[model samples]
Target: MASERIDLLIIGAGPAGMSAAVEARRHGLEVLVLDEQPSPGGQIYRNIRESDPQRLAILGDDYSAGRRLADEFIASGARYVPGAAVWQVGEQCQVHYLLEGRSVVVQARRLLIATGAFERPMPIPGWTLPGVMSAGAGQILLKSAALLPAGPVVLAGCGPLLYLLAVQYLKAGIQLSALVDTAEHRDILQAWRHIPKALLGWRDLLKGLSLLAKLRLAKLPHYRGARALRIEGAECAEAFCFSSGGKVHRLPTNLVLLHQGVVPNTQISWSLRMRHQWSDAQLCWRADRDQWGETSLAGVFIAGDGGAIGGALAAREQGRLVALAVASQLQRLDGARRDHLAREPQGALARCLAARPLIDALYRPQAENRIPHNEVIVCRCEEVTAGQVRADVRFGCLGPSQAKTFNRCGMGPCQGRLCGLSVTEVIAEQRQVSPSVVGYYRVRPPLKPITLAQLASQSNHDLSPETP
Candidate 1:
């Protein structure tokens, strides 16, 4: 009944986790990868393995590219357990996860967290309405179920994803009512300085431009420099409203998709009480990581969007780098050998990230959108409003942890996954301080919800480590 143990335990099966597993196996390290998804690809390439040819064509090559990585990981001899919901990670490299309605524990010599990123919450008024969801959710439907919005749909917010999803939807014969862009002329101006470095990532720039060109060719109603977004409906979203060029426009639509960008999913790191720094450019908290992706704690490392907002390509390279570092640490590879093995991935990682500053600058979420109005719901789980958070700030709620006590802001089922960034920004705006000063929610486990039966099912022997 002793728990399983391995040389390395990875908690995600995204680009980073998959790539790390393949590389670790090459170095003859015993690796085990546990992912909550039923498949290997993370959000960026979700459901790639089972995707049909037509679905792959509609999703584009970038998504289809994950098939190769997933295949390699499957063949790499590393142990992969799908549908494992990891809830608690112990400081001693012990991980507790639920599988098949039962709790299981595992120990590792090293732990790699590649949980990846999620879309930043867009907390405009009526976002909690039934017909409104993040653009990422829309993409998920398309990728996983081959489903498209059936009614009049409006895509709003900034970032390359908005355009990319629009193009995909267009290719799938779904006509969007309009595309309301929240990026302003000033954002473009701010991004200009990063253009030179971004050129090093010319391929990404060209891909972005291609997506834009397709949108223009489709003659989609594209609104630029939009602000003051509001989704109006009595019980569900009916119309998307925004202001652009000093004029307010409201488009009648049954579905409203909103996105600013993605930020690292650092919930696991936060639960571990690792040091995190606020990212001004990305507008989220990032777990501190070294060049090799090791976190502030030894034997624990993070890579991909979980550590920073690098795209999939960067995440793949980071995964390899982290694996190499782990191998060297485990004495499977000497220092010189590790460095030699890391050269290609390191260069590739740099190239992938060269354009990030420009993208971050260009798609920085508007202050109004991030801070939200007093009436707008910021925490969907607890139905906490910006006004409530602001009032709590006035009543001496200094940080997200305090706000939780005052109004249950981050105490909901999501464990502050959706509302953490918004709550921190709202409190900071209310207190006239930086988000770093306001800080984030003090995260704990169970990282995901668990049932009493699951906990009871774990016998003491299963929870105990085997004696050497």
Candidate 2:
């Protein structure tokens, strides 16, 4: 097998990875970045294009920086390998990536994982219909591709993201039938306690308020304390059934945008045998990392949402932090330089933690019996169900771990993130243990789908039959 060594191999090309790649290259390191998408901006900073020069002009220079940075890095000899899906990371810093359907392996002196995040699937009845997607999906359509649905869409979820997406839809000449906020009032009130720590700036809060006003001024129906009852559709989403303010009702809309916040992307970190833990704040497993983005293992680091959910600005700072640490490891910088890079990241992380989202993460739409009684699938990859797991419990399965063994309920491609919390209910009910006790079962590696070729490459290492 051939080998290529880069000083830094960033597994993602999002805001965090982009920043790290730029910083590492500036500090005289050979940097390579790969992304699943065509562009470099992660979820938060959607890579802007000149598809519509007017739209580009409207988005302003602030949003246009991603393209500039991506271009500059590419021009500066930073290899930006887009549309490559990184499948695995080995203990020896070997990365298996499948690009254009061919598996390749490369070793990195140091690895910085900034794999970013994905929307937490908060399942209710009929979420599997054709028109249903995450709020982030809707935002990506407008912000990245300038696409919009052809029918009246319903935006349902909490947090600033919901509103931000709704406004984007409205801006793109699409109309939202209604905007539903499932965030609890007490939770929002309780989040106020963290305001002192979050006093760095009110810009985040102001952005939230701006999005809210944009949705309201667009004359869309807005609902707080709302809940989705069910979505009715056969081939596509015909309409949505939900409740709000103690009133059960049905709203007719062709599309439903769903979100329950986000969880970090720890698939690479986990597959590399890095240590991780459940973040009650985000309600998903996140890689454990230090202030400098160093993971449990040496010569490997985690930055951005792959470690925690601090959004785009925080991710940029984290990328710099990781770059500084990687620079130190390469003997190009000192301890003071590393600390200087981290000062901003730490402050940003503290602010995001003290923001309203932490309080919102306390209740993430999954509890025992919270599964709606209807046609939506929880584990989309497996097509399992609440009824199926409930039946497994009825047939004498002890807990979620056992239920997984018995019925493959939580053993899908997502590794139970989508349905684990839901399955915990059945486990606790059947085993009579605390839901937290049945908390997650043992989490394993390759959390996402990987190719056989990629796995084989790592396991097939041969060192030339030495001494023969």
Candidate 3:
């Protein structure tokens, strides 16, 4: 197996990792970044193909800036490896990973995980149909490939993303059948306390408000109290049925772009045995980090959504902060210099988080199943149906881990990476506890895969005089 060492090993190539690498290299640290995709951009604001840069301006500048940083990371002498799926990570200062179908070990003085997040799914009857997808997934296809699904699309669910997609559809010149969600007056009321935090930064607040204004102008079919109960179709999605105050609503559409919200991508970090905190606002779990981005394990750091759902802006700021801390620890920078480098962006991210306090309040776990009577696939990896999960619970297994042991819902190639959020809701509903009370998940170690030779070689290093 190939083996190498670096001053820092960054386990993602998205905004957080890119940002961290750029700043760290400036302060004189050797950085290596690994990503599963062929290129650098992550799900949000991924690069779109266009003959002209002016054409890319159609989506927004988020992609433009990411492109610049990605290019810089490639040019800055920091090692960049794409098409590498990093499965296991640990606190023992070694990484077991796969590259071109072979296992390799990377020994790092320090490690930073910026492995981003995935969309949260809310299951319903026809959701298993060919057309239903997380809103983020839909946008990734459009943003990355400039492709749009056929026929009318329904943008349902909640959060800023719902409206963001509605606006994107309007810009892409696609007519939306209906934009639906269940938002009570209490949803906004619960969010009010968060406004002051968000209002601290005018630019960030203004940007979010601008997106809302665009949604208002688009004049698409939007429902506040509407809740999708089921999707009805024989082979594919033809229409969806929803309810509000005893009144049933059936929105006719061919595609359903749905997502409850986004949760932190914690699988890689969890596999390293990092402590995870359940963010009630995010309705998902994230790894814990100190102000400087250090995890519970020494030499392992985290930034971006892996630490918290601070969005792209927060993720970017955290990158700068982590870079400074890491450089200082490795002696390329100093404490005062590190603090100075982090001050401005850290304050700005905090202001941004405070400005949209309501965003977090909007994503709390669902109290009811929010699913339909028919079978809706929750764990796509295991092909586990909602009925099967309920059957397992009926047999007395509760909680996601236990439920996984019973029905094998979250155990698959993706592990629980894709369906964890949905399964959490199912577990909470069965246990009749707030999803918060159900608590977040715990990641077992050996976060990435390792080879037998690498393991044996590592253990017997001192036994062989010629090994080094």
Candidate 4:
């Protein structure tokens, strides 16, 4: 098929994407949503439609809330395509994607990228080994397949997901060997500074406290202030090692789940040549946008964790807020009507965003952990090591773009998705500069990998001109 066109095209079906679609439908705007997942929910609420009842009960209310939003999105009548891998996004809202071995293109007046986020880069010794996986990856397995690790499991790292997964494992009646937290004592102390403002979103704070209470009641061998982690194994993970409170501890375990938190998935935004700024507190690059989520590119907007690391609640609110902007831009909603509709969601978004500073402060990954040891692999795609990148820096490769030429750090199948932030941090540390000065990788399309056949299959003709 040749390129298709629509009024509004959305690039994810997570909370943000779904919420935007639902609002766009009410305004009667022609819309389409594309997602890589086999189903509607993004990773956070994956497989909610087909989730087992037992598993749903085990996963808790946050997981269950997605089903209602997804149902509303389905009923809203916006066209939805699942299992679609978006590869390139071009001028005037032209998006190229691959679906089931076929390349497709669509043009729209506006594009909303709700690509969401991924687990923060957690590179350490033996991380590539089997049985050493991210806490988010483990949660997906449990969510999608009800699978749990066979042998004793050790949970390491900080953030709500780590504790949430730990709580879920306990609910599933799985025994854990230990829980090693990388959050330093000073993090908790610094986090207190935000507590006054964080109380504005008291429910979220209470939720974190509740997760902590559950983990404590389970009496798991909890190690606070843990650092210097090393995963040891011959062919697979066998033991987890870290230092805690001036003592070194090693626990025998088969599965080692690691997590630090999450950061925006910025491949699409960066490829669009949108401006980004370093978020000091969140410790990552975020898209520069206006009040209504519009990026530096006029018609392209970003919401959800893709724009910044606000959780699902914030994503949903921001989605609605963006849809209002789109509706007004399309002249489907008059100014008064748009303002009336946006009022509640705008406040909701602010409240949801209020807790982020405290959360980020409480769970910020240590600088040492962020860069890792010189020997540790930095780029999983090209197997580029921290040492190689530092060597590149020593040789006058001052930025990630230059370092990429020297070490091929970000030039791989994943296209710097997994290693961009880590590489930036490593380069900055070596050069004795701030990450903001070092800058992120320069991403280009095809944003994802596509075969030559897929490229050849794309239509030669241009998409129709934008609606005037």
Q: Whole-model Cα lDDT per candidate?
A: 0.91, 0.71, 0.72, 0.90
In model 2, which range of ten residues has the least summed lDDT? Answer: 459-468
Write down the worst ten-residue block by lDDT for model 4.
459-468
**Candidate 1, residues 1-468: lDDT per residue as tens digits?**
133448889999999999999999999998889999999899998999999999998999999999999999999988888999999999988889999889887888899999999999999988999999889999999989989999899999999989899999999999899999988788989999999999999999999889989999999999998988999999888899989998999899879999999999998899899999998988899999899999999989998999999999999999999999999999999999999989999999999999999999988998889889999999999999999999998889899999999999978899899899999999898888999998899899999899999988863214233232
Kindly provide the TM-score of model 1 when superposed on the true structure, using C-alpha atoms.
Answer: 0.97
For residue 85, model 3's alpha carbon misses the true position, in angstroms, by 0.7
Over 1-468, each residue of candidate 4 has an lDDT whose tens digit, in order, gives 333446789999999999999998989887889999999989998999999889998899999999999999988878888998999998589888898787887778899999999998888888988999999999999988889877799999999999999999999899999989988779989999998889988989999999999999999889998988999999999999999989999899879999999999999988888889999899999999897899999999999999999999999998998999999999999999999999999999889988889999999998777898999998998999999999999889989999999989989898888889999999999999999999988899888788999888875323444332
Where does candidate 1 stray beyond 4 Å? 1-5, 459-468
Who wins the lDDT comparison? Answer: 1
Cα lDDT of model 3 by residue, 175-216, tens digit: 888877666667768867776665675665576679878877
Off by over 4 Å in 3: 1-5, 48-51, 244-246, 363-366, 369-376, 385-395, 433-468
Clashing pairs in 1: none
| Model 3 worst lDDT window (10 residues) | 459-468
lDDT of 2 by residue, 253-362 (tens): 87899876777866577566567775555656677788788889988988888888877777877888788899888988888876776677677766655554633543
What's the residue-level lDDT of 46 in candidate 4? Answer: 94
Best-to-worst TM-score order: 1, 4, 3, 2
Candidate with the larger TM-score of 3 and 4: 4
- Candidate 4 Cα misplacement greater than 4 A, ranges: 1-5, 459-468
Per-candidate TM-score against the hidden true structure: 0.97, 0.86, 0.88, 0.97
